[model samples]
Target: MSFLKKLKEKISKQTDTVTEKFKHGLEKTRNSFADKVNDLVYRYRKVDEDFFEELEEILIGADVGVSTVMELIDQLKEEVQRRNIQDPKEVQAVISEKLVGIYKGDSEFSNEINMQEDQLTVVLFVGVNGVGKTTTIGKLAHKFKSEGKSVLLAAGDTFRAGAIEQLEVWGDRVGVEVIKQGSGSDPAAVMYDAVQAAKARKVDVLLCDTAGRLQNKVNLMKELEKVKRVIEREVPGAPHEVLLVIDATTGQNGLSQAKTFREATNVTGIVLTKLDGTAKGGIVLAIRNEMDVPVKFVGLGEQMDDLQQFDPEQYVYGLFANLVETEEV
Candidate 1:
């Protein structure tokens, strides 16, 4: 079957438990985004230039990024013409389909984290402070540990006050060990020690938390280089993944952070946190199209089990569940 066919099947076969989770998690975005699109269908009886214009406004207003929105509108127009779609209500499913297609693009989109089957998988988290970087680490630790994988956390964010303690609190809550040293210690040194500890314990995954300070790009680049060098030296080709955590509530500002950090380091994937707290959940498409980074996970709610693996189909479905073709339609 084709990728789109498989995706639709997966979404159809998705258990109610998971579907409801996404539905509730994306309630705010649904109300803001899907509701508007549904209203557009109600206003416009036929698909025409005016319909496309209003649709563009809705997407741009949802913070989907101008470039991505333009591309989507063009592709959507072509699809509408190709399929000879007319009714405005029938265009809703086409919009969701195109959004997913844009995110997936020509290549496959893998939302899974890169794992080392034989040895340890070192994952580094980077983003500005107050973006829920630390909390994401904690939730991930919980996730891996629940999978029966041994997880170790390294407190490399030495610059931020109480950073170590905060990670420690998470470690304690999640029942994982955190390696750390005194505040003001070299962040690279902390990484070195964590590498040694992971190797000694043969941990399945080692997650490192770095300073959220992004003000000084030069210093940030140098510091990150040092940490990466230490990890690579300790374990050849280590740091299998460098995941950039972004707060969905920040909207486009989060996209700017992704651009800056991508230039600073090799950001393999994105972990979008606090999605439920934002109405501009369309930022996901902007990030994928703009930064070209696959979102690995998303924070749906504030609970421990709320950090869900990013599924593009479910995401689009959740956003448009209320607007999609229904029995009533």
Candidate 2:
């Protein structure tokens, strides 16, 4: 069985708290592409320029991004020539092969979060407002705690109202300590407090949630830089991984946000949230194809376990799972 199907079976009995939390994500994606891709398979039976053209339209429409769609189309075209064949049945296999190839290799697909740093593994999550940054941090805390890693959360998003309380609630749910100051307070102070507490608490991982800014790019950059500087002063070259959480439903917009955040804080890896609900799961491919960053995790739902390590094979297969339409030909 596919890992995702197995994953579903494993997580299903666990209840739908996480599923319900992220149901919108999957619903958005399924409604966006699952049915549409099914419709494509229903309509096409041959490999032709017309088929490729329409297929390109479908993929691009689903927010796989332009570069990735072109790469996929080219790979599909080559596969058609390689076998000296034109059957649409072969196209499915070829598409699967091409999609899996996007992972670069098995090494690239490795999900191990190596914390070979000198001290604490600090993960600084950044993205625009509403990318589930705080929620992702909560889930990460829960994941780390499950692994026997004492985790701490920092409400670095002190600018947003209820940001501290939001993280505190997650801390309570996950059974971790969250350090924070009041709203409108400096995020750097909150992070410093969290780091100091984490050091004393001997936490394995420190997940810091930063403020989400809108239109104030200059202020955002300054604030993130300040947070980084403070952590380095206290923790010695800290902020191990600057993880950027992105909503896959945002499509190309997410990729652009990654670029901006990368410029602002040197993003080390990405955490893509809300993939289960968006048809634009293709954005994962787009980001991989276009950006210098690696996707470390994907939030399929809001459950702690839903924040799964990024697996390209599972994602690609899931995307094309409904390839064989059960409609009358």
Candidate lDDT (C-alpha), each = 0.91, 0.75
Candidate 2 residue-wise lDDT, 121-145, digit = tens:
8888898889899889988888888
Lowest lDDT sum, 10 consecutive residues, model 1, at 1-10
Off by over 4 Å in 2: 1-42, 105-110, 323-329
Winning model by lDDT: 1
State residue 257's C-alpha deviation in candidate 2, in Å: 1.3
Using all chains and alpha carbons, the TM-scores for the candidates as numbered come to 0.96, 0.85
- lDDT for each residue of candidate 1 in 203-312, tens digit (9 for 90 to 100): 99999999988889999999999999999999898789999999999999999999999988999999999999999999999999987789999999989989999988
Candidate 1 off by > 4 Å: 1-9
Q: What's the lDDT for residue 178 in model 2?
A: 79
